[model samples]
Target: MFTPVHADFFNAPTLELSRNLLGQILVHELPEGVVAGRIVETEAYMGAEDRAAHSFGNRRTKRTEIMFGKPGLVYTYQMHTHTLVNVVAGPEETPRAILIRAVEPVEGIELMRERRGKHMPMKQWTSGPGKLTKAMAINMDYYGHYFTEKPLYIAQGNPVESVSVGPRIGIGNSLDAVHYPYRFWESENPFVSKFR
Candidate 1:
């Protein structure tokens, strides 16, 4: 019963798209059940010009090629053991992406609780990039998949009343690009990644 956001929605500038992502719903259709969450936080990485971007200076490898693909695709990769999810954004040839940093659980709460932890506090459940992915069952299997469709997709959800902007987190060596306030999150959202 969720309205899927159009691919054109993500074809805009990365920063704007990231800001607009707040309050959208991320849905996952798994065999066990449908899990969904309202996006509360996101970080934008603008193409190769941005030093923190994976495609920084055209560093396109087999892993990053998909980031250059069309918008509205899932660009996922493993960091250590956990899978991190991103929405491929910007124009067709640009390697831009918006990393979904946090979400507020909206569906399949019990499944999320079971995957994250039954005893953990609600904030710790989906409050971080790694934490939310685990809770929502996002994995590498979703890599390069068109997210404007089934399995994984975004839906229009609650409207963001306000947004907070800040520098991207955990990238200290990226030079001056680190100062760009590309991270967007719902103001005072407790579920936002702890770094916020």
Candidate 2:
């Protein structure tokens, strides 16, 4: 019964969103039922200067349009045939975002286990971008949707302290940009991805 308040959209800037997302609960409701997880790791992608970002250089295409939308919206894309989810950040047209890297399963554990095709321990249930989406039943169809309503949404949860920041992963081509410490996560969360 924890519904996300739409007011989260008022928060501008991807950096704030990246850090604030920690410990927030992400709920995904599908035909089967609801699956929920607590966000533990996130990466901020600033517009233009952040070379690892798709919106870098102000490049706008069919794929990145969601980045230009209002904040608190779900921006999803396909990678390796799997769906990746990001929360739009910054003001309108700013093209900033925070990629949800991992989560710790907190509710609907059975639905997550069934989606993942294995009985993973709670900590390992949603430990990666791809894994979390798969476990929550999110896909391209969810792109450009609102996170405060519909099939997927974010709800308030326990706040995390002792957070850490570091460079993003899997962006070898960005050179120095790859070293930008934009990733944020709960320091004690065991479900954080190993890439950090």
Candidate achieving the largest lDDT: 1
Task: Give the alpha-carbon lDDT of every model.
Answer: 0.90, 0.86
lDDT of 1 by residue, 19-110 (tens): 88899999998899999999999999998899999999978898899999888889999888989999999887789999999999999999
Task: Show model 1 residue runs off by greater than 4 Å.
Answer: none
What's each prediction's TM-score?
0.97, 0.94
Best by TM-score: 1
Per-residue C-alpha lDDT of model 2 across residues 120-145, encoded as one tens digit per residue = 67666688899899889888888878
Q: After superposition, how far is residue 7 of candidate 1 from its true place, in Å?
A: 2.1
Query: Between which residue pairs do clashes occur in model 2?
Result: none
Clash number for every model?
A: 0, 0
Query: Quick one: RMSD of model 1?
Result: 1.1
Cα displacement (angstroms), candidate 2, residue 165, comes to: 0.9
